[model samples]
Target: MKKFFTILGILILVLVFVGTAVFLFNKSKEKPVVYETSSPFITDIIQKTVATGKVIPRKEVNVTSQVSGVVDQLFVDAGDTVAKGDIIAKISLAPNMIALNNAESQLESAKISLSNAERELERQKNLKAQRLVSESEYNKFLLDFELKKERVKSAENNLLLIREGSTLQSDLVSNIIKATSDGMILQIPNKEGAFIVESSTFGSGTTVATLADMNDMIFEGMVDEAEVGKIREGMELLLDIGALDSEPFQAELEYISPKGQQDQGTIKFQIRAAVKLQDQVFLRANYSANADIVLDKREQVLAINEGNLIFEEGAHFVDVETAPQQFERRQVETGLSDGINIEIVSGLVESDKIKQL
Candidate 1:
């Protein structure tokens, strides 16, 4: 009975050992990898580069003061629409003390001269009446009196101009600021009573208001130096404005800067594009935007996911599925790529299945 029990226990131990070895062997084995497959499709592939920038008016005019003065009255505020020659603001002339004093003194002197000439003319008239003065002498005194009177008038006009920025005989009012072009007022930089310097050849005068034609807008942006070489004038661009929820705006590339500017560690080139407005869409100035410049485009071409392509030895290849769970390497000619999907110029047709990597 003892031998029988021992033999049974040994058999149980052997069975346990065999079961553990079988479980470990099964766990160590690796499962077969099933690669996902995809098929090429006919789609439009647009190769484009992105540029960061803002939307601004193509023609912006700074309404500056023509004479030094303080802003007395503003006719237009920011966002007001104005026509050419529209009054933007009124300035109260702050004439120079020296110039004002000089004008006053000149007027006083001219008045005094006129008074003496009048007295001399009256004496000459009396002498002529008594037949003591000759006709030529009387005529000379009359002319002198008239000349003195004219000098007084001229001095008075000069004083008026210096004090008020205008004269009775002049049509142009230097104290009134007007719009040079038809546009919307973008900003009113100066408040009422703010002092402004006059615009002159020596300096850029104070800008009282900023005006721009909102209808004529442009996309001003910068592109990296690497992609600048691929872009040119007259290309099409789609602008995405961050503030608007509408579709992208259409634009035409108009200007490309001849020089490059360095930002951070990368060089960037400036570019400008004319924006084509759509109905019922209003674009504000300086709206932050991004531009997608179309470099090349292929319509309705056979394309596959760019990740499915295998590039080796300066050539492009793809693994085309021959049967279920089987693939064969095939070479292909490529065209434009939009970074996500690539255009297959010549390769397997639409019916061919491609192995997705």
Candidate 2:
């Protein structure tokens, strides 16, 4: 009985040893999670928003045809500089057949009337020479002849104007299209054979070309309605043009639309900024660009990475490490943030280590 009890006691000891080893193995497998730490440093925080738009000239004029006709000649093309009153294109007048016929008929009728009056005047002159008619009656015949002569001349001139777009007594410029402003031609949509509409009281007409002063360029873009209110006129802007990567142009805000237009799902307000360009650098019209509007900025201020900040209620706070691997919740006063780093206004010193959340 004593031997059996000794064996039982040894087996119980073995089972107890196995349980202890299992517990030790599970305890060794557990791992602890750690976080990173950082400290505030002197940095620049530029808070800005980006607006996508295009670069365009400040003063642009569309050259349109004066008469409905086909394009006869184009003297200028895109990138050509022109002065005011310079001939940009010529139009071959497509005269209305019905109007031409009516004008011709009117001229013929006036000529017949003038011929009859001339005969009457000659007869009156003979009668007056014989004292067969009063001087007043002869004078009336002379006035009638003169009036009929003027009408014939007027109708002849009208017929010539309709057929040739110019009359012999006037300058030959009725079908000639001239530049109204001094600028560089940006576009010429009409070719030599393209039919163009005349800009009259009736229609806007076809745009022969678009001209503008490229020296005075502006960045035109739209901004979200939420961001438009924070911006005002005369604010500085930095433009990044996709075409010219090396040129960094600056601009001044000059216009902001009072109303908002719905685009996609958001309301946008159209804005324009005057681009200050260099003489050597040329900014072409309608180049896609992005405008970085600086809303606020801070130079060489105590700033921390925004990741270290924790928001509670409406205030901002951060987890500051007071001891080694030990952090405490501390309320911090923050300033401008460029989205990556936030300016630390108060609550922590340069030596305070901030833990990442």
Candidate 3:
């Protein structure tokens, strides 16, 4: 009976050891690596570079003050359409006290001189009619009197300009700000009671309002120096506006800066493109956008995943599948790449299966 029990225990220990070995062996074995493969297909490949910037009007006219004064009233606000010569805002003249006092004094002196001249001219006319004075002498007095009267008028107009920033004979009121061009008012930078300086030769002065033609819009952006050389005027651009939800806007390159500007330690070149507006879509000024400038493009060409291409010393190769679960290295001529799919110029057919890295 003892022998029989010992034999049974040994048999149990042997079965436990066999089970542990089988479990470890199965866990150590690796599954076969099935490399996903993609076949070359006909598609459009466009190589482009992205530039960040904003969409704004092609020409922005700043409605500036013509005379220094305090804003009394605003006839238009932001987003209002305006025409040339339309009143944008009214400014109350903040006339200089010294200048006003001088103008008043000058006007009073001119009146006194005109009163004296009128009396002298009356006496001269009477003398000439009675033949008591020569005709030439009367003519001289008349000319002097006329000159005095003109001086009085000139003084009066000067005083009026100083007091009200306008004159009786002038049509343009200096205190009234008007639109310089036909466009929509983009912004009103000043409020009622805000004092602004007039635009003069010495300074640009305060901008009362910003006006722009919304119909003519452009995309102004900066491109990296490395990519600027690949672009030129008349190229096409696809604009992606962050504020709009519709399709990307189309634009044509118009201007490229001759110089580069440094931003955040990287040199960037400025570029401008005229945006082609679509119906029912309105693009506001300064809408942040990203532009995809196409440098090269290929239409309906054989392309494959760019990751499948392997680079050696100076040649490009791809692992083309010859049979199921088999691949061989083959040299391929490449073309435009849109950063994902690359154009397969030669050495590959539409039915060729390429390994995905």
Strongest candidate by TM-score? 1
RMSD to the hidden true structure, all candidates: 2.2, 4.1, 2.3
**Per-residue lDDT tens digits of candidate 1, residues 1-357?**
999999999999999999999999999999988989998999999999999999999899998988898999999989989999999999999999999999999999999999999999999999999999999999999999999999999999899988987888889888999999999999998999999999999998999999999999999999999999999999999999989999999999999999999999899999999999988888999999999999998999999999999999999999999989899999999888999999998978999998999
Per-residue C-alpha lDDT of model 3 across residues 28-77, encoded as one tens digit per residue: 99999999898999999888999999999988998788788899999998
Identify the candidate with maximal lDDT.
Answer: 1
Report the poorest 10 consecutive residues by lDDT, candidate 2. Answer: 30-39
In angstroms, give how far residue 256 of model 3 lies from its true place. Answer: 2.1
Better of 1 and 3 by lDDT: 1
Order of candidate numbers by TM-score, starting with the best: 1, 3, 2
Q: What TM-score would each prediction reach against the true structure?
A: 0.92, 0.83, 0.91
* Residues 199-316 of candidate 2: C-alpha lDDT, one tens digit per residue: 8887888999899998888999999988988899998899998788576799999999998999999999999999999778777889999999989889999998898889999899
Off by over 4 Å in 2: 1-37, 310-331, 347-353
Give the clashing residue pairs of candidate 1, or none.
Answer: none
lDDT of each: 0.94, 0.90, 0.92
lDDT order, best first, reads 1, 3, 2
User: Which segments of model 3 are wrong by more than 4 Å?
Assistant: 24-30, 312-315, 319-323, 326-331
TM-score for candidate 1, please give it.
0.92
